[model samples]
Target: MLGLDKKDFTLLLIVSALVLLAPLLLNPFPEGSAMAQFNAGYPDLMQRFVIFGIFAIGFNILFGLTGYLSFGHAAFLGAGSYAGMWMLKLLSMNVIPAIIFSTLIAGAISFLIGWISLRRSGIYFSILTLAFAQMAFVLAASVLTPITGGETGLQPALSDPRILPEFLGGGSVTADGNIPKPSLFGIEMTASSEVAVGNWLWTLNWGYYLSGFMMLVAFYIAIRIFRSPFGLMLKAVKSNQQRMSYTGLNTRPYMLACFVISGMYAGLAGGLMAAMDPQVGAERMQWTASGEVVLMTILGGVGTLIGPVLGAGLIKYFENIFSKINKATLEVWFGVFPDWMTDLMVTIVYPFIGKGWHLTLGLMFMAVVIFLPGGLVEGGQKIAKLFSRKKEPETPGGEAKPAE
Candidate 1:
């Protein structure tokens, strides 16, 4: 297939199918049904799934392959986001320029940070990254207030100059004098169409498809990197960087390169987010945001292709569906039960839903770490093995042989 071995090719096909059909797959429950609350086929949520999938995929490159657990990758994401926002404000509403400039700026920032941070390894390196991220957050919120818009964040306004439109022989302002939304050529990012299939409604979103396409490309690149010789070197670095250093192998450049690449990935995700929403906030660079990617990679299966995407979807699903289960929703779900019984059920389950969704996530993370250290992928493999039938040995007559 696409230069990949049969297994990798099959995996790629499966992912493509999933991404293409996500609106249908994520909306299995019929509209207005009780279970519809769990449906995540909406444009906003779908975009988040693929965008964060890209983030986790990039984080996995450095953490999974090179054993560099960054605690500040979100800085790159934030930087890219600001860059994208600037492009949107000063250039045109078209998302292409913003995305490209976002990537390049983030890569450059990563290169500088990696050059300094890669000097140390282990917890020290992790601490340095965290410090850098926190510094960026503070700077964005305070010192860089003029550029970042401080606590309010940066967003486009109709009054601002957009030179690209003028250069292209068009007015930047619409006839209605509204701030333009991000778009691809003539298509708006928020544009969507709906199809009704019986009681089910599916939303086909331009932004989601665009983000999904980017995610697929990012995934393919990650797969190639994983299977490449450079990927092999990264794995070797993970196994024994100190030994490689003793052997006169300059591991620093490899680590720095991986770090910059990972940062660029984060930046791209941030740019996509801005293109969708056209806003950039300092909060995007917080250490917690960086930690979330780490959790996504670990929960899905670090170093394994497709694990980060799976993990990202799971977490996003939890954030959207589980967190939305309020008392009213829970009551509706348990309406068939007796009043007292329904109340009891809600009381017991309430803590794990709504505001306490993180508790559920924490418990799940703990269970996976304890029981399935290889993450959800290992559990899936185990289930697959259990369902698979073992072939018995055959005799020369082509009949099953009896056990000796």
Candidate 2:
């Protein structure tokens, strides 16, 4: 089915179903209701979920399979954003062209960076990549101000000469005094169709679906890579480079290839973000952003094909939840508790939310590292197996019988 073995095909089906149903699942409250604050079914967050999923999935290709931990991958992401923004600024508002440009630019830059960095292994390689990324970050902020829009970042301009879409005003401005929006052949990405049934209102946006579709494609490609002979070589590289050297197989090219591919993935994600929001900030290239993707991959379970996606969604969702929580929101949820209890709960939880959300994320990472280095997926599987074992029938000799 779908050119995949049974297990792979089933996994694909499950992921597809989840992606398609996300809007409904994420939005469980009515639009006008007070609880709507908790609903993340909106287009912006939905787009982020899938976009970051693509980023995580790509990073997984390199770090998970080959164990080449690049601390500078976010530089590629920022580079892609700039490329996408340029395409919009110079070429057209059509997302297709922007996405293509993003992929190509990121891949070229990554190829160069990988060529230089792959010369060293272990911590040395990590440092080289980090240094390159820091240089790019500094350039983007200061010396390259004219090109990168400086600290203010790149935003669609009123003066851009959109050569292709001559009749239409460039992005950030539409012809009829309407705010400009990214589109595909004039179909606006921000456009949405809202269906209200009872108290629930589901918003299906062009941008979210497009991002989700791209994520699906990326995920499929990752599945193929994981099953390929090249993927086996990456695993071998991770397991023992010395053994591979003994086999007379050069691993540098393979490592470079993995780095380039993963960099392209980051670029794709950054381009999508620019297309959706019509802005590209140098902040996207920060080392912290690179660290976040690594955290997402490890939190969800590194080396497992679906782990990165799960981790991205989980982290992003929690980030949103944490950012939105405030004293008022906490009060609403804890209203039933006594005053002292509510106050105590609020005190305990307040530090984890809002500006202190990073503390929460760090604690979660530490817990995952200490308790289950295999990550959440392994922990979940263990719990499931434990439950299954407990549910099994015991035989006459006090041995457990196989579950029927």
Q: What is the TM-score of each candidate against the true structure?
A: 0.93, 0.93
Weakest lDDT window of 10 consecutive positions for candidate 2: 395-404
Q: What is candidate 2's lDDT per residue for 236-352, written digit by digit as tens?
A: 999999999999999999999999999999999999999999988889998988899999999988988888998899889888865877888888888899999999998988888
Residue range 1-404, candidate 1, lDDT tens digits:
77799999899999999999999999999998878888999999999999999999999999999888899999999999999999888888888888899988999999999999999999999999999999999999999999999999999888767787643322467768777788888688999999999999999999999999999999999999999999999999999988888999998888888998898998899999999998888999989999888888888888889989999998998998889889998898888999999999999999989999999888888877777767778777765564454444332332221110
RMSD of 2: 4.5
User: Against the true structure, what is every candidate's RMSD?
Assistant: 5.9, 4.5
Off by over 4 Å in 1: 166-171, 335-340, 389-404
How many residue pairs clash in all the candidates, one count each? Answer: 0, 0
Which residue pairs come into collision in candidate 2? Answer: none
